[model samples]
Every structure is written in structure tokens, then in C-alpha cells.
Target: MTVEVQLLGGTANQGRVHRVGNTVRRPLRPTSAAAHALLRHLEEVGFDGAPRVLGVDEAGREVLSYVPGQAVTAPPPCWGLTDEALRSVGRLVRRFHDATADFDPSPYQWSPQVPAPFGDGGIAHNDLNLDNVVFRGGTAIALIDFDLAGPGTPVWDVAAAARLWAPLRDPSDVTDVRRGRELHRLRQFVDAYGLDAEGRAAFLPALRDSHRWMRDIVREGAADGVPGFAAYWTAEAEARAERARAWFESAADEITNAVT
Candidate 1:
């Protein structure tokens, strides 16, 4: 009998992911079919930065190939905080977007939470949070947790990544060494991703939308009493989010100048 090791990291799916041999078992969701198809397409296109979708298990869990790497979790490690790791994330995301360019997502019943005008570019790895990406040899190698994977633009994905990686938040909320260097990191990430001039022009607006999008998800999740979301939706968290919005509004020109 194979032992099941509970995988940690990610608040949304906390305690729901397990490792059995060389596979990962996760709870099936309404969006699993879409996610599975997306993974299969990635494989067909030779993208190795994501997990492979195996059949469902007897217990009704979606089985996937276990990718071995260290995810950048809370209170990130020194290696995960490096510019190299950030650049690697940019390259990985670029590759993922390129691979999915031909995928048609109209048939799949994607998550309804993905707002309009945002999902048309292609099927994107909507949640590119720090913990969602896996790193090997101090380099970002793969992305996990496809629960939020669905219709999205490449710029949207880049914005999500920048929001979390460069962080784009109130400096007071950032206790790490990355506190004052958010804009510099943002420029580094976009440069590494090779975002085109047109994409660069649209990035700041996408970043604003990305911020609102994520905040809404967390708020709705907390309202529905999801244990993890509820815990994270404290007054402090709300205050910080508000401050981030204000900061983004005030720094819009500065941010635009940095990336362009």
C-alpha cells in the first residue's frame, strides 16, 4: 500500500492535496474537467512546466503526476526571493502562454468567476501566486494548483504574477527585503518575460484589474465561510488591500514608466 503524504502550501486547497507514489491526488471540482484538458493540451504541445493529468482515482480525486520542486511559500526562502527566480517565473509563464495559444476553451465550462473581457486571450494559469509556482535548483520550474486555470490573457497572467511576486502592495505590509524594490522587480519580471511594447502599454491597467479580481475572490470565499479565506479576510487583511489599491492608483504613472 502506498502512503498518502499531505501536501502543504496554498491556502485554497490546503489539506486537500496528497502525494501517492509519483502522483498527486486532489479533490475534484466543477472546473477539473477544464483543468485536466488544459494539462493534456500542455503535454501534447510539449510544455514540461506543469503536471500531467492521470485518470481519476477510486476515491474520486483527480490524479496528476507529482512534480518535484520547492514551492515558494509564505515567508519565502532566500533563493525564491532572488531576481533569477523572478526571471525564471517570467519565462515559465511566457512558455505556458505560447503553448496554450492554439487551445480553444469555448467548449469547457470554466469558472464563472473569471470576469468578461479578461478570458479571451487564451487559456491562462490565472493564479500564478508564489506558492502556485515550483522551483528547482533555485529556478522556477513548474506551476501547480490549476483550480483557477481558465480563460485569461497573457497580460492578465503577467499582472497576477507581478502583483504577487513584485507584490505591488503597500510597503508597510511588506516585511521582507523586497519592501522598497517593488517597481524594480516589476520591471525585471516584464523584461524577462519579453512583453511586447503593446503589452507593456496595457500592463498597468491589467495590474489594476488583477488586483480587484483577486480581492473579490478572497472576499467572496470568506463570505462563503471557506476556512482558509475566512482566516485570511481579517480586518488587517482588508486594510492592507485598501492601502494597496490607493498605492496603485497613486503610483500608476511611476509604474507605467518603470515597465515601459
Candidate 2:
């Protein structure tokens, strides 16, 4: 196969990702081994929404199946910011959670787990932001960028996904038609995920935690000078995080009432 490389663009992680043929080549990180094992497990369970982890290449980069679709990124296009799209992501995350239910993470070293409640049992995609989800024809088709995958609960994963998709943020900061539908979308997401009473009850706090967890991650990456993260940190990431926190604070009760 021709080895011509194409760089993937985004303002999140620092890794260099390239596309060659139907495969994605990414720089290996400390958590790569655990991520590989998790991908293999997902394949073993017949979950096709995640990429297949093909071992490393000659250059020492971790190779993975290139999921062919458009990745919805920051300032996502209009199609990616719809209510239907939000619900579809909810179902996709649920499927990922269910498929990972039987997998164990004790055998491999992973990135540090997110803080409590989220840091419990089960392997979560951890970072399910819109940028990590690949969509085709406006539907979520696959998940990518598993660098943050590690031990966590399904509810925690859902919260992370919701914070990005439902987008727990102030109306002024939100860029799409979803500005005023935050609570409405939260209800839609929880309903689509089929959360139980307990999960519903825990949703708000998890949402709060997820928001802060992401901020800390960005701060660390920026301090360490990890590529894209540092740029984001210097720009609007922290301010956005604070604004999101404030919005969630005011909207939490309404979200809880709707979820339960």
C-alpha cells in the first residue's frame, strides 16, 4: 500500500494522526497498550463501532482501522448540531457501554482514571466529545481517539458525551441552534440511553464532574506542552470551562427534574 500520509486536524490532543489507505496511524502514548487491548475486546464482542487495533507499524506508530466518515469537531457543522444527532450519539454511547460490560482493565496499564464516581468499574471511552465520533449521513457511525479510555462507569461516559453533545454551556457560548435547548437535549439523551432511576439521579453530579475533569486534563496537557491542548488552553478553553460550569450550576436543577 502507498504510504502517503495525510495529517488529521483538531484542537484537542497533541498526537500526530495520519491516514494511509484504510488505516489510521497515530503516535503511541503510555495508554496505547490498554487502548489496543480494549479495541481487541470490542472486536471480540462484535462491536463494529470502534476501530480495529492493528499492532504497531515499522515506524513505531500504533496502527488502527481508519473509520471512514466525517468527524464532528469544535464549531461543528450544522448537521452535527441537531437534536436527532444528539439522540443518535446517546444510543451509540449506550451500545459502546453495553459492549464493554464484560471487558476487564486490570491486565494493562492505562492513563490515570478520571476522578470518583466516574473512576469506578467498567472501561469507558472517557472522551466521547463530538470530535471523537464519526458520522455518515448525519448519523453517528463510530468512535475514535481512545487515548483517554480507562476505568469508568457508563453513567460517567454518558455524562461526558452529554456535556459535549447536549453541550452543558451558557447560551452565548454555544454556537448553534442548541443554545436554548440544553435541558431539552439532556432529557432526550437520558431517555435515549434508557437510564434507570439511579442513573438519572446521578446524572447532574456526573455532568458537573465530567466538565471539571475535562478542564483539568486540558490544563495538564497545556502545561506539559502537548500540541493542540496547549493552544486551546491559552485560548478559550478555561474560560469556556468556567462558563459551562456556571451554566450547569443554574441549569442543574432543571436537568435533574427532567431526567428523573
Candidate 3:
């Protein structure tokens, strides 16, 4: 999905992101452009956990405040998915929600003209894809990609994170090789987030809805002819999604039983 590369001599992890520099970086819809800016605003206003927007670069590629660290997409086999890590992620998101509480919608805020699937509230980084998060020193520190940020519900945002970390996706999709363990991970994350009985009980089911909705939108992107999304949704994605469906079904019982 990375189309271009340039050396900006800043972040070590992502290695110089704004390569297009003052030119059309890649084929993007206008809203994508606005997202970059919105993320910048959030950073300026104390939402520093995510990438900072550095304005359009030399070639007009969006220059972002690159976060330097590791984004653990999957927990390693030897590495246990610790409660600490889950809590760190929860705290990071909580900070973001709080920071953006007073953020005004510049450039029409998140989801400008297009109606977002989620409601408006704190700038929700609806896309909590594993790769979008940055972890340093054993704690979740920063998040990137405000591309999906918009007026969305706290439940929707939390559900999105759970879908990845609780991993509402298929069990097989979990690279950690843990079968029913992710259920525990879900509990850890929810507990970290300070959710009450209502939020905890509703977590997995809400995540289920997010899972179905998120994938459908990705599929929709393919149908609508978005390049990167289309490539994914075309062939392998379909089968992968099926497996995810099965995996989630297999874990449904544990999800129902788990307590945060």
C-alpha cells in the first residue's frame, strides 16, 4: 500500500513517510487529504499520541509527525499478551478521546461532507488497525492514521480496537497462535479502559457489529474501485474473511463468558 518513499531524516520506525513532497503523493480521495490535516490539529492540541501533521510536503504529499517505535501487529509466540500492554492501549485511547473533546472541526472535521457510519463525538480514530498503533518501552504510546477519525461513538471506536486486539476477527487470523486466549486479552483491554458492567457486557457484541460493518466497508471499497482496498477484497480477502467468521464463531462462547 506504500506507493512512494522519501528520506525525511526523522522517525526511525517508518523511515521518512512524506515521500511525495509537495506533489500529489498517491492516488487519494480528497477526504484522505483532510484526514492528514485533522491529525495534525489533534497533535497540536495535546493529542500527541498519534502522528502530527506537518502540512503538505514539498511534492504535496502529506507530511506527518512520524512516531518512532514498533507497532506490534501480533504478539510473538514467546511473548505473552500481557495485561500491561492491553491497559497501555486503553489508556492511550482514553487520552486521545479526552484530548479531542474540545477539538473543532477544521476542514469540516472528520467525515466532512460524507456521512460517517459512526456518530460524531471525540475524534475517533475508527481505524485501530494493529499497524496504526505505536508501542515503545512495553507500553502503547502513540497512534497514527487519522484517516478514519471522525464523529463516531466511543463504543464504535472501542469496538474497533477490540476487533483487532480482542481481535473480534477469526481465531486463525490471530498470529499469536493462541486459541481461546484472546478472550482473556479482551477482558484485559476492557478492564484497562475502565468500562462498567454495561460496557463490558456489551463489548463483544458491539465488536461483532463493528467487525461486520468494517469488513463490509472494505468490501464496498473494492466494489467502488478503490485501488488498495480492491486488491485486498478481490481474492484472498474473501477466504480470509470466511475463516475469520468461523474463528469468531468458535470463540463466541468464551466471549460470552469472559469478565473484565
Candidate 4:
């Protein structure tokens, strides 16, 4: 059967993605085998939010079920910045984590593995940036772009999500309604995810570490000549990252208070 192809946007990977009927097609990466296995596990466990991998296509691209929803982009709209939206994102991430908890990752060839300060345990969707999520009715519904998924802890994964969705950032760099509500948003996320006392204690510090981790990745990707990361590095990533680091340090007390 012949199908029309539509190019996808909002991705930073150096691969072209296209939509074909009810599925998406993208060039396979070196880590594609691992990502495909992860997706397969998600399907076997009946997790509806993730895409179902359909093996390689005639053109040798990886095919995935097209999750129908709007991908939230940068400078997030007011809807994506709401307290309700923040909670929703947290819950979705928690669900994904729970589903993948027992998945044995030993057989997979995952790449760019994240170093979790807590322990090397659960597999996490390491990159939960705004653009990687799909939203509907002003709420986060599903996550996409699994190329960065790898072994890590729930706290580590949640911390990364909070860094983006709860927006643990320098106020100067934030442009949405979420600008001044970092602490509040962080608390809301913790509450929604039902983090325990110990998890709460570790959350703030984990978030700080995530900032450094992300900045390093951006710099590394740019150095490797990836256009998207290169553009961000050249634009304002350095200054923005430094300021965010300082802000996370200064707000550490407040973040702890909110979550604890």
C-alpha cells in the first residue's frame, strides 16, 4: 500500500522523521536496537502512551505508531505552564517509570547511559524536554524520542523532568507564566509523583546534577557537529546553563522546603 509522507518537526536528532499514515518513520540510530526493544517492552506491558515499534520499513527506517497529539515546543504556551499541566506530566512520567521497573536492560545496547547518583537501577526516559512530550487538552499525554532512554533511577529521571517541566531554571531565562513558580511547581510535581521522605530529600540535589549533565551533553553534541546542539551552544546555552546552575544553588533551600 502506498502512503503519503509528511516530515516531522520539533526534534533535535540528526535524523529525518516522517509520518506515513498511522505510523512514523525515522532513520535508525546506532542505539536504535535498544530503543526498539524498549518500545516493544512498553507495548508488551500494555503502556498506551508510548509508540509501538513495527520493525524496519522498506527504506530501512524504524517505524513507530504515530501518537496523535501536539508536541509542546519551547517558550511553552500558557497551557503547558499550568500547575495542572505540571502535575499531569509528573504522573505520566511516574507511570512510565513503573511500567519499565522490572524490564531487564542487560541484553540491550543502550547508549549515553546516565549516571544516577542514587544507584544504577531503573531505565528512564532521560530526555523529557518540552518538545519530547505529546499533549492533549492542555495536559501531557505521551512521551516521544526514546533515543536517549537508558538505565537510571526514578529520582534521577523525575529530577530531569522537573528541570524542564517544573522549569528549574534561572528566572532570567524563563519566559512563561511558570517563570516565578519554580519552587511551587517542584512541590506540585513531588506531591503528584508521591515521592517519599527520602525521595523528597534527594530531589533537589538530583535536579541540580541534571542541569550539569544536560549542559555537558549540549556542549558535547555541539562539539560533534550536531546542528541543533551547535545552534543552541552558539546562541545562549553557555550563559543560560551557568545562570541556571547558580540559580539552582541559590534556590536549593527553598526547593527542599517545598518538597520536604
TM-scores for all candidates: the values are 0.97, 0.94, 0.76, 0.93
Clashes of each: 0, 0, 14, 0
Candidate 2 residue pairs that clash: none
For model 4, the stretches where C-alpha displacement exceeds 4 angstroms are 1-11, 116-119
lDDT of 4 by residue, 138-247 (tens): 88889898987888888888888888887888888877777788888888998898877877878877887777777888899889888878877864668888898898
| Per-residue lDDT of model 3, residues 1-260, tens digit only | 54565433211123434444323232234576567656666767866687665555445555555577766643441222456766788888888777777766655634432234446545677777766777777788898656556766566677678767765666656665445667777777776776667656665666666677767778887787766577667567788877776766776777767754
Better of 3 and 4 by TM-score: 4
Worst 10 residues of 4 by lDDT: 6-15
Best by lDDT: 1
Question: Which residue pairs does candidate 4 place in steric collision?
Answer: none
What's model 4's TM-score? 0.93
Flag regions of model 1 displaced more than 4 Å: none
1 or 3: which has the higher TM-score?
A: 1
Off by over 4 Å in 2: 1-3, 7-15
Task: Estimate the TM-score for candidate 3.
Answer: 0.76
For model 4, how many clashes?
Answer: 0
- 5-83 per-residue lDDT for model 2 (tens digits): 7655555544467888989888888888899999999999999999999889989999899888887865578999988
Could you give the candidate ranking by TM-score, starting with the highest?
Answer: 1, 2, 4, 3
Task: List the candidate numbers ranked by lDDT, top first.
Answer: 1, 2, 4, 3
Global CA lDDT of candidate 3, please?
Answer: 0.63
Error of 4 at 115 (Å): 1.8
RMSD of each: 1.1, 1.6, 5.5, 1.8
- Per-residue error for 62 in candidate 1, Å, reads 0.4
Report clash pairs, candidate 1. none
